[model samples]
Structure formats: C-alpha cells, structure tokens
Target: MAHPLELAEPNVIDEELIRNCITTVEEISIAEDKKKEMKTETELHDIKAVSFSFQNILRIDNLNGLFSLVKLQLDNNIIEKIENIGHLVNLEWLDLSFNNIQNIQGLDTLTKLTDLSLFNNRIEELKNLKTLQNLNCLSVGNNLIRDVVHAITYLRPFRKLKMLNMAGNPCHKDPEYHMRIVAHLRDIVYVDYRLVDPEKVQQAREQYQEDLFEILEEEKKQAEDEKKAEDHQQWLDTLSEANLSGVDTLLKVMLDEDPEQGKLHHLSFWLEIIDEIQHEFKGMSKDFIDNTLNANKAKYAEKERFIDALRSSRQKSDGDSIALVGKFDLKKKKLMRQLEDLREDETVKKLRELQDLNTELNDDLLELGLRQMEADDQIVSDFERRYGDLVNAFVEAAQNGFFAKIRDLENAFHTRAVTMATDELEHFAAGQLEDVTDEAQIFLGDKDIVFASLNASHDAHLGIIDGLEDQIVTKERKTFNTLVAEARAESHTRDRKRITEIATVTARNNKEIVELIQSEQEGWNR
Candidate 1:
C-alpha cells in the first residue's frame, strides 16, 4: 500500500470534508423549505385582517379564498352590488363605502359582524340585515334611504349597535325624524354625525326626576282635595236635610194648635227674641242694639196692621149688615107700581118695560145675595169644624196658658226695668242657639270663640283644598316639562353617537391614508 498516512489522508480526510459540506447544505435546504411552507400557511390560512381603502383598487374578487379572514375593509372603492360578501363567514368587519350598493342583502349572513360601513353608496333600501345581532357600528351615509324608519325597525336584531350615519340622505329632511330615530334606535347616541352634550344630558335627568316627583305629589294633592270637597258637600247636604225636617216638624205642630193659640205662640216666640235683644242692648253699644230693635219693632208693626185689617173686615161682615136688603125692597115696590101703570094705559109701555127691567135686576141681585149667604154659612161652619179645637186652644193660650205664665214675667221686667241688665243679656245669647249652631261644637268657648270658630274653620278647610289643587297643577306642569326635556336629551344623545362614529370613520380613513403612503414609499424604495 502507499504510505499509510498519505493514502488515508487522501481518501478519508478530503472525502469526509466534502460529505460534511453536502450534509450541511442539505439541512439548510430542508429548513428553508419548511420555513417557506410555514409562511405560505400563515398567509393563506391565518388571515387575521384585511383592508383596502381610498385607493385605485378596482375589485375584491380575488379575496374570496381568504376563508380565515376576520376583518375586511374596502372603503372608498368604486365597487357595485356588494354580492357574494356572505362567503366570508369569519368576517367581523366589512367596509365597502363609496360603492354603488342598492340593497343591504349582502350583509344578511354576517351574523358575527360587529362593524359594517357602507357609506357614500347608492343604497335606496336597507333589507336582509336582520341577522346582524352583534353589529355595533353601521354607516350607510350619502345614500338614498327613503324609509329610514323601516330600516331602523329591520335592524332591531343589532341590539349592541352604537353608531349610525345617514347624513346627506333625504330622510334627514324630516324635522322630527332624527328625534324619533333617537327614540327607536337602541344605544345610538347621535344622528347624522351630531354629538350630544354631557352637561345637557345631566340637566335632562334632573328635570325628569323633578317631573316625576311633581306628578306624584300632584296626584296625592288632587286625591286629598277631592276627598275634602266630598266631605264638605256631604256635611252641607246633611245640614240642609236636618233644616228641612225641622221646618216640617214645626209646621205640623203649628197646624195642630188652635188658630189663635198658634198665632199667640208664634208671636210669643218672636217676642222672646225681642226681649232678649232688649236685655242684651243694655250692655251692648247703644246704636247697634237700637237699630236691631227698631227693625224688629217695624216687622211686628206690619204684622199687627195685617191682623187689624182682617179683624175689622170680619166684624163688619158678621151678619145683619143689610144696606143691600133695604135697597132691594125699595126697588121692588117701584117696579110693582110701574107694572100697574102700564096695564092701565097703553101709552105707559115705556114705564112697563122699565118696570120689567127693574124686576129682573132685583131678582138677580136677590139670587146673588142668597148665594153669598150660603157661601158665608158654609165658610163659618167649615172653619168651626176644622179648627174649633185649634181656636179654643189659641184662646186659652192667649188668655190663660203660656202667655199668662210669661205675662207676669214680662210685667215684672217692665216694672223693674231700672234693674234688669243681667237677666235680659243672658236670655238673648241663649235664644241665638237655634239660629246659629248646626253641628255639635268641636271646642267649648265663649260667644266670640264660637263665632271665630265657625268662620275660621271654614276658611281653614277651604285653604287646605286650595293648597292641594295648587300642588296638583304644579306637579302636572313639572311632568310635562320633564317629558319634553327627556325628548330633547335623547335627541342630543343620538347626535353625539353619530358624531363620534363619523369622527372615527374619518380617523380610520386618515390612518389608512398614512399606511398607503408608507406602503407606496416602501414599494418605491424596493
């Protein structure tokens, strides 16, 4: 063999160095292939996000294979008919603004979508978006949303919705449309990019609380007032009924008495009041007492005049008053003589006619008197029959009963008028009980207290009722004011939400612009 060292070195050392080099190259190649495959999987199967905005990018059809995509943005694109976008099952965000979309059917199957923007599109109707329950922001501005109310209704599934933009649309032309939108839309704070003020919202809340409180207070007051009015009216009704019953009882008692007794009792009752007044007047101011006494005296004088006239007429007409009888006999004789003269002489025809006329007049007058007598007799008998006992009782009372018993007292007062101050005043005040008090006294006091109690009690009761009514009116006004304030507050809230959404969109567009510029710069550098 060749020298051992030389042969071994030539065969083993160089070959081993070459084999190690090949093995190293092979390992490097394998690692490179694995890395390439990993990168390919990451790019094709693990797409986390995608955005294409405000660029000359014409289409998105090539992205259909991105099944693992989570977000897709194609804003400011001149695309049309957002078709086949439902193929993106994993997509959560989709923005295809500045397009020619006419309907919202493309977003129907995007159940997991939380954000979707289709601004500056030609969409006239929003349909088939009922499944987007997780949507938070939806921008469909610069489009023809004719029936925005219907669109909002259809989008009820999106309970988490926070932002909506429909500016530059015809629907905003309605004066109350935005306010109603704020009312119906859940969680939306603004409309057409307008924002609400926080201070205003707090004020509105305070106003609403005040309103609610006012309403409650008012209702309570109204209830109390009604109750009080009912009680007062019932009390008055009861008093009126009692007065009617008392009057009826008094009338019956008077009717059962003899007419003279009835008249005497009535006069005595009035006379007692007069005596009381006279007694009270000794201690009272002279002028007031004198005026009251004079008025009563005038009333009594009129009653006496009426009684005197009736008595005079009755006495004059009592029987045997016969001027009419005397005249009738005289006329009868004259007529008889004239008839005799007419029978003897034919030239006495006029006299005979006159006699006959006079006879007829006499007969008529006699018949009339006979009827009057019969009527008078019937009247006297009927009067005695119906009221004979009443007359007797009256006569006895006037001559020897209650009047007789009080007559001595009156005579004593008249005789001792120089020493009669205390007794009369007491009597006058006591007699006023029936004329004044209706219900039992709630409190015991003197005459002044009684008078003050009646008047002051009425005023106090009415005051309470009036206070309740005022409370009711105040509360009602507060409630209405609160509602109006809430409405305006809600509108502002919606406006804020809309403004925030628009700002966010604008910020995103700006960011996209930066990214596009960087990408362009990087491409240029490459």
Candidate 2:
C-alpha cells in the first residue's frame, strides 16, 4: 500500500534523504529479484558507488553505514572540504573536481584509492597525502600550485603515482618544467595527459643530474647569505647598545668641573679627541665598503657559475646528439623519423624566439640592476653633498658667533648656578653642555669629537637610515626577481603551447605518411 520509492530529486542531500534513496533502491532490487535469498535488505548494504554531483549538497554528512563504497562523484558541486569520506575505506575513485576545496585532507583511511580528480580547485599545496600509498592517478590541474619543484618534492613519497596531470597550474609554466617533473617522478608514465617519451625522460634525467651540484651550491650560498644578514643585525644591535660609552665618560669629566677651570684645558686635548673619533669613523666607513664589495663579488661569482652551468648544459645538449643517440641505444628508424620531424617542426623556431625574448629580458634585468646601482650611488652622493653643506654651514656659523652665543648662554646659566650649591651648579652646567653637544654632533662629529657622545648617537641614526635603504634595495631586488620569474614562466608556457600545437599537426602529417607507406607496400606486393 506504500508508494514506490524513486531517486531523490535535485535537492539538498541529508542523512534521512540518502537513507530513503538507498532503501528505495533496495526495495526496487528486491521486487525485481526472483530468488528469495536475493530479495533481502543485505543487498542494499552492498552499494559500492554513489553519484551526488550537481545535487545541491552543501554538506557531506550521515553516510556512516556505506562502508562498501568504492567510488564517489561529487564533481561540479558546492562542496568546500573533503569531509566525512573516511568511512569509505575501499574507495578507489574520487572525483571532487570543480569544487571549492582548498586543502587535500580526510582521506587517511581510504588507502585503496587509486584515481583522484581535484581539478579546478583552490589547492595551493600538495600536502596531507602521505598515507595514500596506493594512489596512482592524480589530476590536480588548474589549481593555485606554484613552485613545481617544491610540489614535486611533496609528491616524491607517492612512488606509485604513474599518471599526474598538473597542467593549467602556475607551476606548469616553469622553465624545463616537463624535464624537472619527469626527472623527479621517474616512474610517471603520463604527464599532463601526454605519453612520456622514454628518450625525453632519459635526457631530462641526465640534464638534471649534470646541474644538480650547481643547484646545491646555489642553495648553500643562499643559506650563507641569510646567516650573514642575521649576524649583521645582531652586530648592529650590539654596536648601538655599546656606542658612545667612552664618549659619555669623557663628557662627564670635561663638563663636571668649574667652567673657568674647564676652559684652562689645552685646545690640543680636544683636537686629539676629535682626531681619534674621526679616525674611528673612517675605519668604520672603510670596513663597510670592503664588506659591501666582498658581498658583491661573491654574488657576481655565483651568477657567473650559474651562467656557465647553463651554457655547459646547452652546449652538451647541442654537440652530443650522436653520442646521446648511441648512449640511449635509439633505433635507427625511430631516430631517422625524429630527425625528419625535428627538421620540419617548429620546436627549434620556438626555442629561438624564446631565446631572443630571454636575451631581451636579461638585458632589461641588467639595466634594472644598473639603474638600482645608479640610484644607490645618487643617494650616497646626495647624502655626502648634504653632509658637506651641513659641515660648511656649521663651520661658517661657528666662525661668526656660534661659540659667542654659547658663551652668552653659559653666562646666563652661571648666574643661576651661583644661587645653588657647587655640586648642583656643576650638574646643571653639565646638562646644559650636553644639550649643546647634541646639536653640534650633527655636523662636527665627522671632523672632531667635540660632541663625541652625540657623534655616536648620530652614527646610530645613520645606521638605521642605512638599514632602511638596504631593506628598500632588498625589496626592489625581490620585485625584479619576481618579474623575471613571471616573464620566464610566460615564455615557457608559450613555448609549451606552441610545441603542443606543432605536435598535433605533426601527428596528422605522420598519419598521412604512414598511409602512403602502407599504400606503396601494398602496390609492391601486387
């Protein structure tokens, strides 16, 4: 008397609705079965696959009983996370493509999974997949993945991965991307839906092996650079804390005495102090320049090594074709066919175009570096000119009435000091002199240490300014590197696209050639 069960309508999926749909299917199966044993509720529990794609399902819940599930299709849905799928221990195929998922998770129990399609998702990394040892085919194309090398490293544990589709990801556009992936994932038979050419794989492995040492060296240099930066920062902090301690003691000794008595000190005594401070500052400037030049030299040497490695790799690829053929034991017929194809193909043409573009980009990058250097030089020149003007102004002002104004100011303070105790008067005079020394340090610090404590303070301020300028340069360099990376990625992407197009056209041409060869053989047989 009950109404016959039917498939659920395209509505929000819930636990009760899913159960009802399962029960309905079971009832239908029972009605269709002729044998009594086959018409039991046990057949309902054996359901292995479920398709809820485009079913307006907002959440994946209440499927605790479907333990026998092997396949689940939730593609083109509004699902945002991979949740509640752990109960499907036998799951083999999962299609969550065209969803909103960001992270790959909740599949630790599904060790039997072999095929997974997560294309067109928000996945930025390939982590949290360590337990899926049985996974073989993975499609994560059209995602936010960058740094193909790092992504490949994440996938290194999945040795069983034979087919990987990473096309349409930003990483797909990296230079030598195909070679890198093939070299890393040696067992992968298909990459981005294309058959892996064995010859290409071997070539990639050889090339990668040749450059591996250079890459490691570069990494070591980067680590060293980072450590150097940290050490420099620590040194700066210590210098700032310890700066002017000696100058402070000298100031206290000079200013705490009676003004008339302090005036009796020879000019040579102050001049000697000033000369010592100038020498110290000169030493610091020389050391700074030497360190900067050394760093630049190391950077230039690293770049030269990188360029040499690149040239060596290119030369090896170009000059050793015969040797490579012999080494790989290539068949004569296949080699001949490949040679013919290469002659007619646009791969070389595209490579030339890319090389030209790369040359132009390199020129631009060099120009940018030169411009940055020029800007830095200009800033230094401006700072020096401004500093010279400040010193000249201070000298001119001093020659006029700077000391007279200070003497008049000191006389007024002296009059007030007479009304106070001698110790209090000395303290007050010292405080007043400290203020004057601070102002004088701005310009005279370079020539003399009349305001030696103030000079240290000024140097600390300059150090902070220098640090800021360095940070600016570092930021600009990072921006330039990013721009260069993006340009190279774009060029590589274009090259790959052109190669794919040419390959498609060549396949058709090869088909025609095959048909003609077959026709000629048939005629000869006749």
Candidate 3:
C-alpha cells in the first residue's frame, strides 16, 4: 500500500484530477510561438477555488499554474512555514488552520486577501501581513500570540478589518482582554466569537482616556524638566568660570607679597595687610554697589517683560471682546427684525379673523344640527305612524281572510259529514232488509247505530283540522314577527351608518381646518 501522506503517483500530472478537485474553472486562449509560427493556444483557464484540506499533504507546492485562484483551503496539514503562495495575486480567502506553520511569510503577493485563517497553528507574532490592506476577517485563534499591544500595532495597517478571532491565544487571557483589543482596533465589529458593541467601545475609550492624558502630561513634564536642567547647567558653568577667575587673581597677589618679609617685615606686612584690608573693603563697597545696580537692572528688565506680556494679553482680550460685541450687535439687529416681522405677520392677522369666523361657523353649524335633529325626529314619528297603520290594516285583512277560509272549510266539512252519514244509513237499511225476516224492527235498530258512529267520526275529523289550522296560524305569526324584527334592525343599522358618516365628515373638516392653520403658521415662521 502507498503511504497515506503521499499522493498516488505523485510525479504524474493528472489534468482530469486537477479539474475534478477544482470547484470552478474558466477557459482562455494564450498566444504561443511554435517553430517560429505564432499560434493561439486554448487551455483550461483558471481554477477559482481548491480544497485540499485534510489531504495529509506535506507541502504547499505544485500549484503554480492556478493564476486566477481566489480561495485555497489547506487546513489540517503538515506544512511548516507559509511559503510558495506568493504567486496567487487574486487570492482573497486562505485557510491554513491546524497546520504546523510556525511563522507567517511568503504572502506578500496575495494582496487581494480579505479573509485569512491561521487558527490552531504554531505561529507566534502577527507579522508579514501588513500588505494585505483589503483583509477584513482574520482568524488566528489558538495561536502563540502573547503581546496584545504588539499584535494591535502590527495589525493597525489593516484599517478595513471588521472581524478578528484571537481566542485561546496568550494575549486574550489578559484582564479586560476584549476591551483592550476593542480599544485598539475600534473598527473591528467581531472579536473571537463576541460581537463588539458600540457601548463597549465607548467605555473602553473613556476608561483609557485618562491614562493616555496622564502619559502625555508626564512626557511633557519630563521634556520641560530636561530643558530646565540643561539651562541650569549652563548657568552653573558661567558662575563657576567667574568665581574661578576671581579666586586665581587673589591667590597670585597674596603669593607674590608673602615671602620677602621678616620681624620688621612682619610689621610692614601687618601694615600692608591693614592697607590691603582697607583697599579690599573699598573694592567690596564698589562691587556691592555695582551688584546692587545690576540686581536693580535685572529686576527692571523682568518687570518690563512681565508688563509686555500683560499688555499683549490685555490687547488680545480687548480684541476678542470687541469681536464679541460686534457679534452681539449683529444678533440684536437680527432679533429686532424678527420681532418686527412677528408683530406685523399677516398670518397672525388671518388667524385672528379665522378664529372669529370659526365661532360664527360653529354657531351656524349648531343651529343646523338642531334643525336636522328636529327633522329626523319628525321623520321618525311619521315613519312610526305609517308603520303602525300599515300593520293594523294588514292584521285586519289577514284576520278577515283567515276567518272566511275557516268558515268555508267548516261548512264544507259539515256538508260532507251529512252526505256520508245519510249514504251509509241508506246502504245499511238496504242490506238489512235483504237478509231480515223482521225488516222494520231490524232497520230501526241499525239506523240509530249507524247515525251515532258517523257523528263520532265527523267530530274527530273536525278536531284534527282545527289543530292543524291553529299550528299554521302560530307558524305564520312567528314568521311575521321575525320579519318585522329584521326590518327594524336594518333600519337601525342604516341610521347608525348615516350618523357615523356625518360625524366622520365633520371630524375631517375640522382636521383640515387645523392643518391649514398650522401650515399658515409654519409659512410665517419660515
């Protein structure tokens, strides 16, 4: 079996395999010179994306022909250093995560890269990525990054970076790590897996602002102190030179007079000493006077400088005050003009007129509403009167018709009962006489029995018909009542709808009037 890390037949260039591995391809033609003759060479143009992730590849090589490649995924590999990828000029996305890479290098040409993933790598410092200006997303999590500030400084050139993943790195373990990173890289929207909100960024800025100001102030003070020390050293050098010359002259004069004197020389020496003392005293008095004059001159010079500074400051203040007064006068004129305009505004005058007219209009509308209500009441009363009359007439007509129908049915039933009873009695008499020896006695007894049976049957039929008529009358009365109730509900709905329409119209008119007044006021303001 072949080694798992090696590609089968590594030396062979399988065009078909390359095409299969590539996600997208384009075709193009290139000019080629063959045997001193120019020919157009057609070839598979370029691969757009290639994924060899987890392929156990040892090195990133043999990809020189993919000039237009935009994305390459080579994560989980044994590659050590980032190399051999400088030719991918159009590459925008690269994944080298989970690799043995210790340093980021050889990516100088891939300037179009917008996303780069070096997660789970041995890479330490964020370096050699300064040229990737278009980079927006970077994932270097689980790496060996230590100095957060150094990393921020290194990544500062990538101003468009919006997403950065630095989790599991040594730099991310610091206290307020997210704030530190956000404070430096304010353009980033996402750090690690956390979304950086505007409030956090603001808080970071506020938290660090005082520290930054203190640092700047300390630097300024250090510079000033250094300058003052330099000036003090120069002054000390000048004073030492003056004092050294004076001491040298006094020593020379004393040495020249000391050796020649004895006892009388001692007396002469004493007298010379007294005379020298007097001369020294006179010189001291003159030097004191000169020193006093110099001190006074220095004091006067300082006072003049102070006076000049005060005069300059006062002049500036006066100039600023004059400018402010000029501005105040201009603003006052403008305000006076605005006040005059407000006083003379035609819109305000029109508004007053409209207010007076509105009162009259409201009075007229109220009177019209009262008249409408009275008219509506009169109409309702007339409608009720008409409805009542119609109902009464319909009821009277229905009652008369129902009574006529009932009377006719009753008369018809009576006639039919009498006819049937008479026919039945005759048939019984005829049949009895045919079979009887005592015809007259038999006929009399059967006739009474037949008449009694017919009467009972007729009465039962009349009772059934009466019950059916009562049921029909009840059902008709219920149907009529239902119809009347429905009609009343419909009338009420129509009246309510009419009232709502009138109210809506009134409200709309009022809104329009208010809007007109507001528009007029706005126009005047403008």
> How good is model 1 by TM-score?
0.30
- Candidate 3 TM-score, C-alpha based: 0.36
| Regions of model 2 farther than 4 Å from truth | 1-11, 15-44, 210-526
Best candidate (score: lDDT): 3
Which of the two candidates, 1 or 2, achieves a greater TM-score against the reference? Answer: 2
Query: Model 1 — which ten-residue stretch has the worst lDDT?
Result: 18-27
lDDT of 1 by residue, 1-526 (tens): 3222222222211222212212110123457665445434454445555555544334345455557767776665556566666778887878788765676676677788987888877888777777888888888888998776677666644668878888777886766566546555546765566765455445544545664466458768988999999997875564332221121122223224323322222221334544563454333323322333344354345436544543454344333224444554465466556544443344244334444544554454445444444444454344334333433333343335322333343344333431232343344456633333222222222444433433443344334333433443344345445634553454356445534543454345345434544554565578
Q: How big is the positional error of residue 511 in model 3, measured in Å on the Cα after superposition? A: 88
Worst 10 residues of 2 by lDDT: 242-251
Off by over 4 Å in 1: 1-41, 55-59, 196-526
Q: Is candidate 2 or candidate 3 better by lDDT?
A: 3
* lDDT (10s digit) by residue, model 3, range 476-500: 4554456446645654665466456
Q: What tens-digit string does per-residue lDDT give for candidate 2 at 1-526?
A: 2111113333566654554343222223444343333323444457666666666555677677778877777777667789998988988888898877899999888899999999988899998788888889999999999989888777866879999999999988898889998887858999999999999988888888856566557768988999999997776654333221122122233343324323212222344444554454445434433444444454345446544544454344334433432432333344435534553334334334433443443344344434433443443344334434433443343323323333343344333333232333344345533443443333333323333433343344334333433443444345445634653454356445534543454345445445544554565578
**C-alpha lDDT of candidate 3 relative to the true structure:** 0.59
Clashing pairs in 3: none
lDDT value, residue 256 of candidate 1: 40
Off by over 4 Å in 3: 1-17, 24-44, 210-526
- Model 3: how far residue 496 lies from native, Å: 97
Error of 1 at 107 (Å): 2.3
